[model samples]
Target: MASLQGKVISITGAASGIGLATARLAGERGARLALGDIQAEPLQKVVGELKAQGIDVIGTVLNITSNEDVDNWIAATIKHFGRLDGAANIAGVTTKEAKYPHLAEVSNEEWEFVMSINTTGMFYLLRAQLRLMLPGASIVNASSGTGLFGRPGMAPYSASKHAVIGLTKTAAKEYGPKGIRVNAIAPGPIKTPMLARVYGETKEESKPNEESKPKEDLKPMSTIPLARFGESPEVATLVAFLLSDDSSYITGTTRATVTGLLGPPRFWQPASSRKSTYGYLPAGQELEGEAGSPRLGLTPAQKLAAAEARRLSQAQKRAQGQLHRAGIEAQKQERLRKKRVA
Candidate 1:
């Protein structure tokens, strides 16, 4: 692991989710932080928490969409910390409306809003940070799984994320000679407030009765091979790795933090439920003496082993699903308690 002691780092969207997770871990690693977010109260709270722990931190209220705000935040960082070693631009937004309409129905306002924050705002942020960063600095930007592959009903968001990757690559090349590194992270369906909003669920209605609800109803989560959503700390670790000297040779690439979810949600059936063998000749049937023959049988032992493997895999998957539901319940209770306090 790269040593973060005494290093000064800047982070946007530091009030919550992956950004907040990164800030917390970075602080624990001994880095001084310059945190910025539009949510002033939450940002200040985080700053106070870190300061109470003896971590050096400064917080600012910033709207990434404004060039001036971007510049000011960077200036504030340098003014407070005296230098910048790394930065994570983890702030971005999606549409408020769920079930995004077709491309033809996407409004001009929606397209511009997403582009302004996700792309143009990133440009501003990167430029400002790079202007003050010394050689050997690193920066990580937020991208999405949608950036790598297209999905229906999310043309604007997808396009904006694709543009983010482009910016990351171009910046890496432009600054490589200066010893600065740039990279992007593409995460799929993280369990964040943003995701809850995307699913049209508030804290009160977020957790469902797993026993009563069919597993298929989980939609995207069911499609992931892990059968669970990723936690914020998972992405935080990736961002920290990219920002640290541990990843000195890495740059100009988009790293995915999804839980083995390659693309769109597709209907998945377990091995026993699937009708086709998918060309897996059952474990150990001997081929006929004929040169070009196919045998469709399995030895008793082979069948037993195969069945054992499938059973173990299914059992592991079920355990993971149960653990994920438990986590969701914990998150729900915390949210509700916070609401009550407010």
Candidate 2:
């Protein structure tokens, strides 16, 4: 194992996905952890588990969009761990609502939300970490494959991630002389909860073949050169390496962890298939009525409602899945206990 003995690493979005994986690996490699996430229950659960295993850890609920939250998290880390050695700025969000939409169709609200979190939130993380980082400390920010290239309907997300690279590089130069290393990892098609949200949530993944679109071509696996979604641990290992002494000489560079996919694939296949009855109608604009066409296009209000319904549905499914997994875990523990008694 690559040892991180005596190193104290702070991670954002640490309750789940990439952050959770990195925390586990960091524990295995002998590092103390300061984990921050927006999800309180999960954050506490993860921290409790790590503590059970004797891993030094402290977790807090953090809203990365707030400068105050970021600042306090960093302060709490230093207070708990005594000093900070490294950080993984891994908190971010994705979107499917803006998929395949024209740039003009994107709303100011949507644009601002994505940028505020993915871009500005990262800046907050870097700022706070750099303030207290001792010499030789490392910082790894999470960018995306889309950050490297543009994708249709993903303007806001792509732009935000791209900004992450710029921030990473700039900070690397600023801090290199002081012995701090800053870098980014552009991961492609990682099988994360965030990816699930982008691709219509966890329930969509489990739907029968008959229920899903039959003609859908070029799935995420097919788009990637490796023909598979990258696992969380795979990316975590890379993050650990970047945050460890092994990559001490590396800085100011963004590494692509994509499975040989150079850029985004053509998400929209058939040109005719791209056509929809509900076109991109700007807010406050009336929908065009086609008397000859059997249906009038959906109004802007209706479209927003549909999108909200999908979001809520996805959330419900995700919650159910979590509960199901918890039940399974309880059962497994009971079985183990009975075996021990026997």
Each candidate's TM vs. the true structure?
Answer: 0.73, 0.73
Cα deviation in Å at residue 161, candidate 2?
A: 0.5
- Clashing pairs for model 1 are none
lDDT for 21 in candidate 1 is 93
Error of 2 at 305 (Å): 42
Model 1, runs deviating above 4 Å:
203-218, 259-342
In the range 1-342, model 2's lDDT, one tens digit per residue, is 567888999988888899899999998899999999999999999999999999999998989999999999999999887899999999888643424345777778878888989999999899999999989899999998878866555688889999999999999999999999999999987888776655455665432233222123223443455657889899999999999999989999999886334321122222333322112212233333332335444444545666878999999999999999999999999999999999
Per-residue lDDT of model 1, residues 79-136, tens digit only: 8889999999998886534435557878898898888988998999999988999999
For model 2, the stretches where C-alpha displacement exceeds 4 angstroms are: 96-100, 203-217, 262-342
Measured on C-alpha atoms, candidate 2 has an lDDT of: 0.78
- TM-score of predicted structure 1: 0.73
